[model samples]
Target chain A: EPEVTQTPSHQVTQMGQEVILRCVPISNHLYFYWYRQILGQKVEFLVSFYNNEISEKSEIFDDQFSVERPDGSNFTLKIRSTKLEDSAMYFCASRGDPSTNIREKLFFGSGTQLSVL
Target chain B: LAKTTQPISMDSYEGQEVNITCSHNNIATNDYITWYQQFPSQGPRFIIQGYKTKVTNEVASLFIPADRKSSTLSLPRVSLSDTAVYYCLVGGLIKAAGNKLTFGGGTRVLVKP
Candidate 1:
C-alpha cells in the first residue's frame, strides 16, 4: 500500500536555529496535514493544507511555523528559531478524496523526531 | 467535537480477544467513530471506522449502538505484537476546508504471552 514518507527520521538542533521537515504524501492524496506529539502528551494538530494554501491552523501553529507544497509530491514544514519546547515528534499525514461514500482515513508517516537543545 | 472517554490501559493474554470501548455522549448526526493504533515511537495507524451499527474489516471490527453514544473496537486473537495504544476519535465526514482531527489520550493495551 502507498504511504506517507518523511525525511530525517531524527534531528537535533540548537535553540534559535531554523529547521525544515520534509514529507512526501501519497501520490493521489489531495489533503495534507502536520501534527506533533510532545513526549507523554496527546497528538496535536498543527495545520492542514489543500490546493497549495493553508486551510486551517491551530494556535500552536504560530508565526514560527509555516508549511508549503513546494512541488506536486513534496510538502514541507519549516520552523524558524526553534525553542526547547519545540522538541517533539512531527508527523505528516495525507488523505484521499473527501467524498462521503469513500472511507476518509488519514495515513500518517513514521514521523520525524525533533530534538531541540 | 465530542469528548471521548476510555480506559487508561488494559492487559490481555495472547490468543485472547480484546475489546476497547469509547464513550462519546455528545456525538452529532454527522459524526463518525474511527479507531487508530499506534506503537511506540511510531505514528497512529488507521484501523476501522463506522457511523452506526457494526462495521467489520480484515484487521478489526467496530460496533456502534443505536444511540451512538459509545463504540467498541474488537481485536480477535490478539498476540504480543498487538501491544499498542488505541485511539478513538469522533468527527464529521464532510469535506470542509481546513478540517482537522483531534486526538485524545488513547487506551494502552499490553498483550502478554
Candidate 2:
C-alpha cells in the first residue's frame, strides 16, 4: 500500500523562528490534509488543500500558517514564526476519490514531531 | 461537521470482543461514520467506515443503525497489540473542494493479557 511521507522526522527549533514541514502525499490522491496532536491531547485538524490551493482551514490555522503543494507532489506546511504552543506531532494525510460508491479513506504519514524551545 | 461522542476509555482482556459506540445525533444525510486507530507516536489509521447497515473489513466491523445517528466499532478477540486510541469521525461526501473530517476525543482501549 502507498503511504504518505513526511520529511524531517524530528524538528527542533527555537521559538520565534520559522519552520517549514514537508510532506509527499500518496500518488493519485485528490485531497490533502494536515493535523496536529499536542501531547496528551486529542488530534486537531489544521487545514486541507486541494487543486493546489487551500480549500478549508480550522480556527487553529492562523496568519502564521500556510500550505502549498509546490511541484505537484510535495505538500508543505510553513509556520512563519514558531511559538512554544506549536510543539506537537504534525501529520499529513491524503485521500482517494471521494465518490460515495467507493469506501474512501485518508492515508496518513508517520508524522513529523516538531518541538519549539 | 457533526460532533461525535464516545467513551473515554475501556478495559478488555485478550480473547474478548470489544465494542466501542459513538453517537452523532446531528449527523447529516450525506455524512459517513468512520473510525481510526492511533498507537503511541503514530498517525491515525483507518479502521472502518459505513453509511448505514453493517460493513465489515479485514480489520474490524462497523455497525450503523437505520437512523444513521450512531455507529459502533467491534473488534473480535482483541489482543494486547490492539491497545490504542480509537477515534470516531463524521464527515464525508460533502459537495465542495474538499471534505474535511472532524475528529473528537477518541476512546482509549487497553487490552490486558
Candidate 3:
C-alpha cells in the first residue's frame, strides 16, 4: 500500500508564531484530511479538503487555520499564529476516490508533533 | 454520522482471544463500521471494516449483527505487541470523499505476556 508521509516528525514554535506542516498523500488518492490529538484526548477532526477546496471542517478549525495543496503533490496545514492550546499531534490522512471503493478507509501518515510554547 | 459507545479499556494475557464491542444505536442503514488500531505515538492503522454480517482480514475480524447497530472486533491469539488503542468509526452514506468521519473515544487494549 502507498503511504502518506509527513515531514518534521516534531516541531516546536513560540506562541503567536506561524507554522506549516507538510504532508505527501498517496499519489492516486483524491481526498485529504487533518486531525489533531491533544495529550490524553480523543483524536479530533480538523478539516477535509478535495478539488482544491475545503469540503468540510470542524469547529476546532478556526480562522487562524488554513490548508493548501501546493503544487499538487503536497498538502499543507498552516497556522498563522500558534497558541498554547495548539499543542498536539497533527495527523494527515487520505483515501482514494470513493467511486472506486465502497468500503472506503483512510491511510494516515505517522504524524507531526507540534508544540506551541 | 452515528455516535459510537465502547469501553474505555480492557486487559488480556497473551494467547487469549480478545473482542472489543462497539454500539451505535442510531446507525444509519448505509453506515459501515470500521476499526483502526493505533500504537503509542503512531498513526491509526486500518484493521477491518464491515457493513453487516462478518468481514475478516488477516489482522482482525469485524462482526456486525443483522441490525447493524453494533459491531465487535475480534483479535485472535493476541500477543504483547497487540497492545494498542482501538477506534470505532461509522461513516456516512457517501462512503467516499466529503463524508464526515468522527472518531469516538477508543478502547485501550492492554495485552500482557
Candidate 4:
C-alpha cells in the first residue's frame, strides 16, 4: 500500500534557527495535515492543507509556522524560529477522497522528531 | 470540538476480549467517533471509526450509544502484540473547518501472557 513519507526522521536545530520539515503524502490523496506530539504528551494538530492553501490551523500554528505545497508531491511545514517547547515528533498525514463512501482514514508517515536545543 | 475521556490504562490477558470506552458528552451531529492506536516510536494508526450504533471491521469493533455521548472499542482475542496506546477522536471530514482531532490521554492496554 502507498503510504505517506517524511524526510529527516530526526532533526536537531539550535534555538531561534529556522527549520523545514518535509513530507510527501500518499500519491493519490488530496488532503494533508501536520501534527506534533511533545514527548509523553498527546498529539496536537498544527494545520491542514488542501488546494495549495491552508484550510485550518490551531493556536500553536502562529506566525512562526508556515506550510507550503511547493510541488505536486511535497508538503512542507516551516518554523521561522524554533524553541525548546517546539521540540517534538512532527507527523504528516493524508487522506483520500472522503466522498467515495469510505471511512476517510488518515495514513500517517513514520514522523520526524524535531529537537531544538 | 468534542473532548473525549478514557481510562488511563488497562490490563488484559492473551485470548481475552478488551474493551476501551470513551466519553464524549459534546459530540455533534456531524462528528464521527474514531479510534487510533500507537506503538512506541511510530505515528498513530487508524483502527476503527463510526458515526453511530455498531461498526465492525477485521481489526476491531466500535459501539456507540444512541446518545452518542460515549463509544467503546472492542478488541477480540487480544494478544501480547495488541499492547499499545489507544486514542479516541471526534471530528469532521472538512479540512478547513478546524477539523483538528484532539487526542485525549489514551488507554494503554498491556496484554499479558
Per-candidate Cα lDDT values, in order, are 0.93, 0.91, 0.90, 0.90
Angstrom error of the Cα, residue A16, model 1: value is 0.5
Q: List, residue by residue over A71-93, the lDDT tens digit for candidate 1.
A: 89999999999999999999999
Clashes of each: 0, 0, 0, 0
Task: List ranges where model 3 is wrong by over 4 Å.
Answer: B95-97
Winning model by lDDT: 1
Displacement of the residue A30 alpha carbon in candidate 2, Å: 1.7
User: DockQ of every model listed?
Assistant: 0.70, 0.69, 0.69, 0.57
**Pairs that clash in candidate 4:** none
Per-candidate TM-score against the hidden true structure: 0.97, 0.96, 0.97, 0.94
**lDDT (tens digit, per residue) of candidate 4 on A10-96:** 999999999999999999888899999999998888998887888889899999999999999999999988999999999999987
Q: What lDDT does candidate 2 reach at residue B105?
A: 90
| Candidate 4 wrongly placed segments (more than 4 Å) | B93-98
Pairwise DockQ winner, candidates 3 and 4: 3
lDDT of 4 at B107: 94
Answer with 2 or 4, whichever has the higher DockQ.
Answer: 2
lDDT of 2 at A80: 83
- CA lDDT of B4 in candidate 4? 91
Candidate 3 per-residue lDDT over residues B63-93, each given as its tens digit: 8999888999999999999999999999866
